[model samples]
Target: MGDFIDVEQLYDLAMTYSVKLLQALLLLIIGLIIIKRLTSFLRKRFERRKLDPSVRSFLLPGISLSLKILLGISIATMLGAEMTSFVAIIGSIGFAVGLALQGSLANFAGGLLILVLKPYKVGDYIETKDHSGTVNEIQIFYTTLDTPDNKRVIIPNKELSNSSLINYSINKTRRVDFKFGISYDDDIKLVKDILNNIVSSHSLIIQEPEPKIVIGEHGDNAIIFYVRVWCKREDYWTIFYELQERVKLDFDQNNINIPYPQMDVHVSNS
Candidate 1:
């Protein structure tokens, strides 16, 4: 009789645990389906917001993982696991891992900030203090750039987020600045007229702002004229080089002397 009672008790315990395991399995499957649908729904909404591909790639997985973790906790509780102890263990593991990869975590956060805020996007021509290039790819930990000379440069995303960069391609039009210095003896009016003519003749230059031509400074060797012209961003380099060449040629024809640095010394016999 004692043996039979022990067997019956063991059988009841086994059946109870089996039922809980089945319930846990069912919950896991249902939770996964819900997570999938939710992820899909969010992706479509992100597309409507026109979020960058990098941002979506980083965010979707994070969201899915977080949801699955919560589902796991729920399933574990259903399976008779103590919630407090389980959460505490997970927290301890996470804290240790975070400490081990602190720098990586910081960079990861920086990349996320960059992707969401968009100070500069891929395809933008950006200039940093030590680097200038066209952005080719923006990733979670780093970014790739193709320089004007066709060199590929990889930069840490943390640096990009922390530093100030100039995005030349962000605007449709950009102002090209030029400083031309001529001998103080040259006719200021003639120089101004020549600059105005050159700027007006350029087909790429925009007219709404009107070119600025004015005497800027009187230096030891020359008088400077500060010239500014607005042009389409695509035409900026072309207009810049063309204007310099035209100015030099026109100045030569008009006998305007572009001054160079010189030293004047008086020799004394003492």
Candidate 2:
């Protein structure tokens, strides 16, 4: 009789827990769907505010993770866990774990600061003392970069946030500067005209700023002509290299002498 009673009680307990488990499963699915919609809505709102892309990339995942944690706690509470005690236990455990993983926590903090300050974003070409690359991703602990040579680099958030960085792609337009030195005997007006023609011929160079070509300084062996031209950021290198090559070829054709450093030293025994 006792064995039969035990079996009956076991069945009762199983049925009772099974119902709660099914309800929890349904709640979990519905909660996830709601979270997805909520996150999407928040993303649109963030975009409307014109928040930085890096900030958006960093914040959305954090918010979703937090919401999901809360959802989990709610489900646990519904399964007969004490809400207040459960939260307290979680809080205490998080505190302990945070203390244990202080370095990781610092990296997380640095990542937050980076997102908030808007130093650089994904697709921005940035350079540091050791690394130079286009930013590929920003994660909680590290930032990934794709170098010009097609190498991938992973930098810790702590090091990146603390270091000085140059963001080359921040501005819409970039200035390409060139200093060309010609022999003192070369005709200045002719050289300037050739440079102007070169600038005008190029489709990539912008016309609004007006290409600057003028006598900059007189070097020991040559007269330095400074050239400054503005172009779209992506076209900067193309314009720079092409102009240099064109000027060299044009100068050779016109017999406009490009002077090299020469020192005339007379050594005599007095």
Best-matching candidate per lDDT: 2
Tell me the whole-model lDDT of each prediction, alpha carbons only. Answer: 0.90, 0.92
**Candidate 2 local lDDT, 52-161, one digit each (tens):** 67777778888999999999998998798998899899999999999999988888888988887879898899999899999988878788899999999998888889
TM-score of 1: 0.69
**C-alpha RMSD values across all candidates:** 5.9, 4.4
Across 1-270, the per-residue lDDT of candidate 1 in tens digits comes to: 999999999999999999999999999999999999999999999999998766775678778989999998899889877989998988999999999988778888888888879888878999997999998877667778899999999888889889899999989999999999999789999999999999898899999888899888988789999999999999999999999999999999999999997789999998
* Lowest lDDT block of 10, candidate 1: 52-61
